[model samples]
Target: MITGASSGIGAAAARLFAAQGAAVVLMARREERLRALAAELTASGARALAVPGDVASEADAAHAVKVAVTEFGGLDCAFNNAGYATAGTPLHETDAAVYERTMDVNVRGVWNCMRHQIPAMVSRGGGSIVNTSSVAGTRATGASAAYVAAKHAVIGLTRAAAAEYGERGVRVNALVVGSTRTEMMEQVLRTAPELEDRFAADAIQKRMAAPVEVARAAAWLCGDGSSFVTGAAVPVDGGATAT
Candidate 1:
């Protein structure tokens, strides 16, 4: 199952997993987009389900998992990719509403999913979870204070969950994603054209990642290939964190 599967990295991951023969359960606020993607997957003879809802609500998160389990039989892997990205601004100057919403979607949303997903995995004997974090989780420059703080909290949750659940057969990890060419970034650039150059300058590759690039990393973490990797904050950011 993947949250935020309506577009960008989540969409790419859904496609990739379905292509690899995994039935995908996609959740996002964009019902139309989610349905379209599911139809596309279904047309290709892959199993897909669309569950539209905000990840921040516990009820919504629980419903998403329930749908996945009911339709797909059991939850094997989940990519907790639903989140909000606020623009870069000073801590004091940022709007309180945006700050709170950022925490609600980015931090609390992941928490809600994990709270339910972990137990389901436990019941099934094991599963893998990959939470989409960002370079902001490790550094302070890419976004506002709230976004950075929420992502940092994500990494903390990943580590704590990994330690707590590893012996229980569930693995949890976070992806330290860099700048990716997603709708959210496009919106940021539309509002602040200067961000384009700022993002390009931060990475050694001098370019933002495609959604597929991040999706591939997430797929590996979710699959048995990375069976020994847990509590890891894998960087799918083109050397952004290295510099």
Candidate 2:
């Protein structure tokens, strides 16, 4: 199952996982995109389903998982990648509603997804979960205080969930992503094109990552390849944290 599967890393992960023979369930706010991707995957011989809804809604989260179980037989993995943020203006200058909105989608959204995903995984012997975080999850960046705080909370939640579910055959992990070329980064770049080079410089590799690059890490954590891995903040950043 993949939330935010309509685009970016979430969409990339769904494609990669389906190509690897895993039945994928796509979830996001855009029903058209989700159904379109599902059709494309099905055409390629993958079992796919589209469930469109907001991750912030617990009912939506739960329903997505249920569809995966009913259609694909059982839930094996999930990527909680739905998130939002407009800019990184200083906290004092930020609107209160913006802060709450960021928290609702980034933090509570992950919480909502895991609450249902874990049980579904447990019922089927075990599974893996990959939640999206950021370099801001570990260090201060140019983003707003709310985005940083909410991302940090994702790591906290991942660790706690990993500890509680490891013995139960479930592995929970997070991605400490950095300067990726996605809609999120595009939102920042559209206003300051010159900042693209600056963002690239922040990464030791001197370039933004393709969403597929991060999707590969997420796929590894979800598959048996990383069975021993849990509670990890795997960095998909182009060595952004190295600095």
Candidate 3:
């Protein structure tokens, strides 16, 4: 199962996972796009189900998981990648609604997914969950303070869940993502075009990541190849965190 599967990194992950033979359940608010992607995958001979819903709502998250179990037989792994961010606003200038919405989609969304996903995973004896954090999760960045704090909370939730559920055979981890050429990043760059060079320079590779780059890392974490890895904030940041 994947949240935010309608576009960007989530959409890329959906395609990658489906191509690799996993029956994918996609959850995002964009019903048309979600169904289109599902149809595309199905046409390519892959199993895909589009469940259009917002991750911020507990009921929606629960329903997505239920669909995954019902259509695919059980939930084995999930990528809780839905997130909201607004940059360039200081905490004082940011409206309370912005802060609440940031926390709702980034932190609470992950919380809701894990709450429902873990049970199905436990029933099947094990599963993997990869939450999306950010470089802002570790330190101050150009993003708004609300975004920074919300991302940090994602990592905290990932670690806490990992520790609590490892014995139960569920592994939880997070990706410390760097500047990627996602739709969100593109929008940010469009607003402040000059930030493009600055964003690329932040990475040691001197370039932004493609969504598929991050999706590959997510796939690795979800597969048996990463069997012994858990509770890790693995970096897919093109060396941004290293600097």
Clashing pairs in 3: none
Candidate 1 colliding pairs:
none
lDDT of each: 0.94, 0.92, 0.94
Q: Which candidate number has the best lDDT? A: 3
- Pick by lDDT: 1 or 2, better one: 1
lDDT of 1 by residue, 1-243 (tens): 899999999999999999999999999999999999999999999999999999999999999999988988899999999989867878999989999999999999999999999999999999999999999999997578999999999999999999999998999999999989999889878877888988978889999999999999999999999999999999988899997
Worst 10 residues of 3 by lDDT: 83-92
> Which pairs of residues clash in candidate 2, taking residues 3 or more apart in a chain or in different chains?
88-144
Q: Which stretches of candidate 1 lie over 4 Å from their true place?
A: none
- Predictions ranked by lDDT, top down? 3, 1, 2
Put down candidate 2 lDDT per residue, 27-99, tens digits, no spaces: 9999998899999999999988999999989999999999988887889899999988767688999999999
What TM-score would every model get versus the actual structure?
A: 0.98, 0.97, 0.98
Per-residue lDDT of 64-150 in model 3, one digit per residue for the tens? 999999988999999999988876686789999999999999999999999999999999999999999999999887888999999
Q: Per model, how many backbone clashes are there? A: 0, 1, 0
User: What TM-score would candidate 1 get against the native?
Assistant: 0.98
> Native-vs-model 2 lDDT?
0.92
10 residues in a row with least lDDT, candidate 1: 187-196
